[model samples]
Target: MALASAMAAIAIDTLLPAFEQMRPAFGLSADSTQLSLTLTLFFAGMAVGTLFYGPLADAIGRKPLLFTSLGIYAGAAVVGALAPSLEVLLASRFVWGFAAAGPRTLTQAIVRDRFSGTAMARAMTLIQTVFFLGPILAPILGKGLVALGSWRYTLLFGAVSAGVLALWSLRLPETLAEENRRPLSFATTLAGFRSVIANRTTLGYTLAVTFGFGALFSFLASSELIFVDVYGRPSWFVPYFSTMSAIAAGVSIANNQMLRRVEARPLALSAGVAFTATSGALLAVTAASGGLPRIGVWILLFSLANASMIGFAPVAISLALEPMGALAGTAAAVVGFCSTGLGALLAAITDRAIAGDVMPIGVSYFVYGVLALACQLWARRASKPAHI
Candidate 1:
């Protein structure tokens, strides 16, 4: 389940190290920001895929849909590898992301089908801990592959991984029970969608996750440019990127331990507070430094903020899906769509604002942090018992 969820991360992070090689190969300028479109468009595809995959998973079965999606993912990766132009590559990436969303969304539903409450939180935390390995290792792997050949090698690697995962997933039994299956119809789908939006706690935490994702996405879309171009640390990009991911992964492990004693809601709220604080600090430092803080200080705060945002994710998601019951598939889809689809659009604003400094990243994170915290607080309030 963890490995399947990481497919999207693998597709995205593995390609980051190839940006330098990709520029010259596609006749783009050395400073071109057009490559960021790859990330955004892929996210756009995921957003769209979520609307269909969730309902389909609930209607059909998890295993069949998963297999079909993985097969398409492999094919899309191959097409991306052979793309003759930037437009073709971006188009293929969208298809790849659309296919990847099936696995990503289903992992949540499958887990929900098996566990709930604190157990679900722990399972998700552990899955996320394992999932972070993709981001930590993919950049290094991509760099090695790019060194050996070209960016296309990374795409080919994604194809190979997807094929292997598809085979491995055959071991997974269909978790959705026969009686729990919902009929595929416009009315049923609309009802599922309505249920998700009408639930206060679910909608609130989903939005919290969305804004948190916006902050993370902004960092991702701009990190390479900030490190390689602004700081002139082309060689340090992978190490730094991996280190940030490592911090988030480490925090996830710690969070899993913390969850044994702490309630997921309070813990998630604390993480949101920490996220907002760290983001505010980054913004203050960036503003004081004329939109370019010292690299050491910047990375330190960035890692903390990133870690906090990641820490809030599993628990908040568990909370959002808790009240969902049999609606887990649709609810997970709505969460995935809002967080990835809407979040990517929000991050694009910051991505385009990025030029020669990290100010936009800082500003975007601060704003997103505040919004996420607000949503978390609202969720907590909404989850409380009311008395006359």
Candidate 2:
């Protein structure tokens, strides 16, 4: 599951350093924001593709779908590497994102099959800690690759890595039992979605994760601009970006440790509070400074804010999936769809607004943070007894 999750992150995060090179290679203006579209489009594809893969996983079992998704993802990566134009590359990337939905969505289903409650949350955190390692190291690896060759090599690297991971996945046994499998049908899929929607707690946490993901996506989309354009530290971009992701990785690891003593709900709510507070402070500093703050302050507070939110994912996902034993794939699909789809939307909006100033990104962080907190509170209230 960790490697599966890392596939998507590696595809996007690794290519971040390649953004500068991509524009020129594709005959784009140096200042074009279109390069960022590659990321958003990849996400858009995931949102669509999960709808198919999730239901198929539930119907056919995980192993076959895993092979299918990874094969397509690998092929798409090769196409992206050989793409002769920006249009062709982006189209290939969208397909790459689409095919990736298999691993991205089904991994959660596989985990939910084995565990529930706090243990499930713990598993997710531990997996995510490993998952976060991809982002921490991807840039350094990507930067090295770019230094040695070009951005196309980075895409080719992803192709090769994904193929290897696909083969590695074959060794694992199927988690979804034959008796538990749902027949593939429109009515069955709809019924599963309806069940997810009727559960207020599931719906609430799903939205919380959605908005939370939006904030993170916004930060990621603008990060290159933040470190490279705003701070004028191109070489420092990977180091600082890795530091930010490292904080999230550390928080997930800490959350895994704390899960032995803590429940997921309160911890998630508390994380939301901390995340909102961090973003609020970031907004204040950015407003006072006109736009960019001192690089040191910005990086510290931004990383901290992002870290707080990162801890919430495992908790929220576990809570949402607790009541979804029979429909883990479909449930995960809805959650992934909302989070990735809405997140990509937020990133696109933030990308357009940032222009050259990063104040918009700061504002976006605050806005999404507050929205996530509100959803978290509502979820808590909705989950509680009236007597309490």
Candidate 3:
């Protein structure tokens, strides 16, 4: 499950070091912001794909839909590798992301199938800890590939990984049982969507997760630019990126330990507060330094802020899906769509404003952090039993 969920992260991070190569290949200028479209469009595809996969998984079963998605994912990556034009490459990336969503969403549903409450949260945190390895290693791999040849090699690597995963997944058993399969119909899907929307705890925590994703996505869409273009530290990109991911991964392990003693809700709430504080510190430092903080200071605060958001993800996700019950797949889809789709949109907005300064990233993080905290608070309140 962790490996399947890591596929999207691998796809995204493996290309970060190759942006310079990609821009020239696509006939783009050195400073063109058009490359941001690659990430944003891929996310747009995931949003669309989420809606299709979730309900279908609930109906047909997880294994079949997962296999179908892996096939498409491999094919799309090959297309992306051989794409002759920028338009073609972007389109291929969209399809690749669409296919990637199936595995990513199903992992959550599959885990929910086998566990519940605190156990589910612990399982998710462990999955996420392993998942972070993709981010930790992908940039280095991308740099090595770029050194060997072309940026297209990164895409080819993605294709190969998908093929390997497809082979490995053949041995896995299906988690969804025959008794739990929903009918494949519009009404059934729509009813699931309605249930997700109508539940206060679900909707509130989902939105909170969305805001957290928005902040994280903004950082991701702009990280390479911030390192290479803004700070003129191309050499620092991989190390710093890996370090940030490593910290988040380590925090996930600590959070898993904390879950043994601490309830998921309070830990999640504390994380919200930490996220807000760290982001506010980032904003203050960035603003004080004229949007160009000392690189050490910037990275330190940014890592902490990123860690806080990521560390709480498993708990937040488990909370959102706790009330979902049999609609796990559909509810996971809604959460995935809102977080990836809306989050990507929010990131694009921040990315567009990042010409040579980190102000936009700072502002976006602080604002999103506060909004996420507000949503988390609302969710906590809504989860309380009503007085008779």
The best-first sequence of candidates by lDDT reads 1, 3, 2
lDDT of all predictions, in order shown? 0.91, 0.87, 0.90
Q: What would the per-residue lDDT of candidate 2 be over residues 216-332, giving only the tens digit for each residue?
A: 988778788766776778888888878877888889999999988878888888899999999999999989998878878887788888898898888898888887889999998
**Which digits, one per residue and each the tens of the lDDT, describe model 1 over residues 54-139?**
99999997899899889889999999999999999999989998998999999999999998776788899999999999999999
Q: What C-alpha lDDT does candidate 2 achieve relative to the native structure? A: 0.87
Clashing pairs in 1: none
- Candidate 2 runs further than 4 Å off: 384-388
Which regions of candidate 1 are displaced past 4 Å? 384-388
C-alpha lDDT of candidate 1 relative to the true structure: 0.91
* Best of the two (1, 2) by TM-score: 1
Q: Which stretches of model 3 miss by more than 4 angstroms?
A: 384-388
Local lDDT at 153 for model 1: 95
Candidate number of the best lDDT: 1
